[model samples]
Target: MGPPILSAVDLDKSYHSGSAELVVLRECSFALANNERVAIVGQSGVGKSTLLHLLAGLDRADSGEIRFGDRDVHAMGEIDLARFRNRHIGMVFQFYHLLPEFSARENVMMPLLIAGEATGAPARADELLAEVGLEERGHHFPSELSGGERQRVAIARALARGPEVVLADEPTGNLDHENGLRVMEVFERVHARHQTAMVLVTHNQELVSGFDRVLRMGPGGQLEQTDQEAPR
Candidate 1:
């Protein structure tokens, strides 16, 4: 409905391990429109996660610029980048990186607290948990929840910061078919309700089909457009 919410230009990332340079992503470029759902699919080592990291400002690229509206994420320093990411991007991972010590409510509240809005943290956390279908389980810790439930909590946590873009890395990698589908349902709900642009890195074809567009990664830093409609 508007100009691109996120754009990656000539992105490249490489790591020097010992004497060899391992180039993970090369010249990868793409644009994600506002409220768009996009999937990144590829081989294990093709750098899907690396690309997500760069886009989410979790890491830096050797060359390239990630634009979120008017801000160039690559140019932000550590403090500004952290603040910018907290306010503008939400991130989810396959492992359900919830703290074992905190209840689901507290876990989701962590991001809000970090952003210095502790007063309404619990109320907002509860609202997000309910949205993700984890209202009754808000008192449970990570170890007490199932894989799907944990991911639901993670989804709630990610949305807690009220970000414009949500980046998920291998979100369903550790779940069974039923749980994975349930987790995906929650993702869809989040996207629809928040109108947040989503960039999901998933190897599961079924999951990839849920997005508006699919981008495939190839060796030597190639990104090719695949399906452009939501799979039915």
Candidate 2:
């Protein structure tokens, strides 16, 4: 095994509700290995999404440190952090946050465009769309696509930058059984092919099968390792 690609230590976070302080994570910490698929599963309000957000640098922690390789994520300045996040960490949310104005191909091209590449984005976008099984839907806008198709577009967009870590929170929560299965198949296929470290947290227990590891988060943000079998 190699050194962790992403790691958090003594992660602490909380929110204030009037006079009460709701502690979400109490010094939770973990290290994700290279190309590892980790599922953090728990019911709602148990800090699953909070953990993912912290991992992605979308939210700051109350206390602790996060390391993406040797870079200090928590301590970096906003501009540098934003660049690092854009280049290294890919995030997928429950609601496919596709730009309604942009077509599936354009949406997938976003990361490359943001990096100041005016040319070659479209071709890369098309390749990603096809990889996610969205080649036929590439010209469609988010509003014109099915829920699963939208999610596939989102997945394709996330992979556009070839991120080292892909953090997905409730990625399949909005899909039906069939659509959810489709999304997972595409996600697994892409993950296996790219060797990207994927951390997906979901409340749905049925989707836990193909992950390399399952981490069950309790009601209080406690974590325990459960299984490590992954399909080949």
In candidate 1, stretches whose alpha carbon ends up further than 4 angstroms from where it belongs are none
- Compared with the true structure, all predictions reach lDDT values of 0.88, 0.88
TM-score of each: 0.96, 0.96
Report the C-alpha displacement of residue 150, candidate 2, in angstroms: 0.3
Itemize residue pairs with steric clashes in candidate 2.
Answer: none
Cα RMSD for predicted model 1: 1.4
Which runs in model 2 stand beyond 4 Å of their true positions? Answer: 227-232
Least well predicted 10-residue stretch by lDDT in candidate 2: 223-232
lDDT, candidate 1, 95-190, per-residue tens? 988999999999999999999999999999999999998889999989999988999999899999889899999999999999999888888888
TM-score of 2: 0.96
